[model samples]
Target: MAISGPSPFLRYGVRIANEAHTSLDEAAETLGLLGYAVVDSGLDADQLEALRARFNAIHAANHASTDVERLRAIGEVDLLRCPLADDPLFLALASNPRILELCERLMGAGFILNQQNGIVNPAGAKTYSQSAYHRDLPYQHFVSTRPLAINALFCLDPFTLDNGATFVIPASHKQEAFPSDPVIAAQAKQIAAPAGSFLVLDCMVYHCGGTNRSAADRRAVNHVYTIAMMRQQIDLPAYLGDDFSTDPKIRQLLGFNHPTARSVEEFISQRKAK
Candidate 1:
């Protein structure tokens, strides 16, 4: 069939899908129409100050970048073997409602938090450290089907033009990858939202966090929600474990069961983690 749509992934489901106009679901649906499967909001005013406090602690403790942690943990494998889900700061980041709503829209009825991490884009950080365009989901090991996934990065500091912000190729999720052109790379759009802005993105879309050249650090928290079928990078069971109720939403997210009756897929398999 000659499709008259942007792409299958871009297909925005039905309207009034989330109790009509008053819900965040409607906003998510609208974002889907643009081939972006996620939506993010400004940080809730109530938690902004607390977030700032936590950001400083994370920076001082040298836990801002995954690559850094991954390297250090590998060297001292015993000390860092624990899954990242148990981190209290991470838990706080995962509970953001704006993130919850968008994840639900893309991953279906019971999307749950899978990962929490941070990045402090300091001024004059190495260029490659910011990363080149890539898809978070395309490279992950998946089973018979692709589970839905969404990712959000909340800018703790204002992402301005001078300081680098994330750059995304709109509608690129359907492309699976981007074209190779020096000109396009130079002209690609940068998403520079102010502090407190949430730059949510579809997991499969091609994007890259930009380099920071400003006089200060540009911080953000990176969190991901995956459909129940997929193995979270950090096991849910190990993270929240027994501290909370086991509702289906919480259970599936805790890696107790697959939500929506889906299958499990992992890059590196382990019987106990899930």
Candidate 2:
């Protein structure tokens, strides 16, 4: 049978449009329409190398010995908990004005860093758990009128097809429901971009890691930002403590501004005290 609509991935020119885009508004608009957009992170080769070294140091400290161990402790290897504490670069990149701007456009003024993790897909690492096609906010059953979360992937190494570049379903974020059929789920396109590329994506988009078939490792830093009203995936405030709470922008993004009232009465009382 003849195809009805153009392939979702094809419609976006995702595979072909591998050039770096620098405009924040253009990137935001592309993401709004296609569920994701890849743009230059403005990091040069030296910066990329430094970031990679920092990530490796943190990963080594965690003692991810084997592929099985790394896979088993993906959260640990990925530095899921308090990654900002692991490296200062994490804080700088996650809070970059360009990144914050896109997030603010999607999630309003106050956006919380829901999660930041290191993604290292090494070759011959069998039994890939991250390869499962899924959404970041998997537990949420309902859709929000506005995007509840924005995810940015900071590429530490070039994301090539063979090294398991991320696979995403274009326009899937707009769907009120998840794809049920296996065939429908298989249509996701792999996003290939060079090192120093930052991919911004809607949290609701259907996406997943592809298997690492190449000899080299595929590395990226994943940062997820959510509406400030929602609780962060990790208690960034507790980990960061009161010291880094001085900056207004960082404080707000870290959810320090979120009220700690026990109830409506207490909330009012606390507000009155302020």
Q: How many pairs collide in each candidate, listed in order?
A: 1, 0
Write the residue-wise lDDT of candidate 2 on 1-274 in tens digits: 1123444444543555432244776777778778898867777788889988888887776665446465466444444445577788888888877888888887888678888888778776653556777788885656666789998988888888888888898878888677767745576789998899887888889888888888877788898899877777777777778787598878887787875677899899878887
Report lDDT (CA) for all predictions: 0.59, 0.77
Best by lDDT: 2
Per-residue alpha-carbon lDDT of candidate 1 for residues 1-274, written as tens digits (9 for 90 to 100): 1234343443356564323343465546544543343244555666666677766755555544445667545542112222234345455566666667666656667566666666666677655444567766757433222336777777777777777788877656555436458745665678777777667766766677777777887777777677766667666565555655446655655556542223355522444455
Error of 2 at 189 (Å): 1.0
Residue 122's lDDT in candidate 1 = 62
Model 1's TM-score against the true structure: 0.68
Highest TM-score: which candidate?
2
| CA lDDT, candidate 2, residue 216 | 76
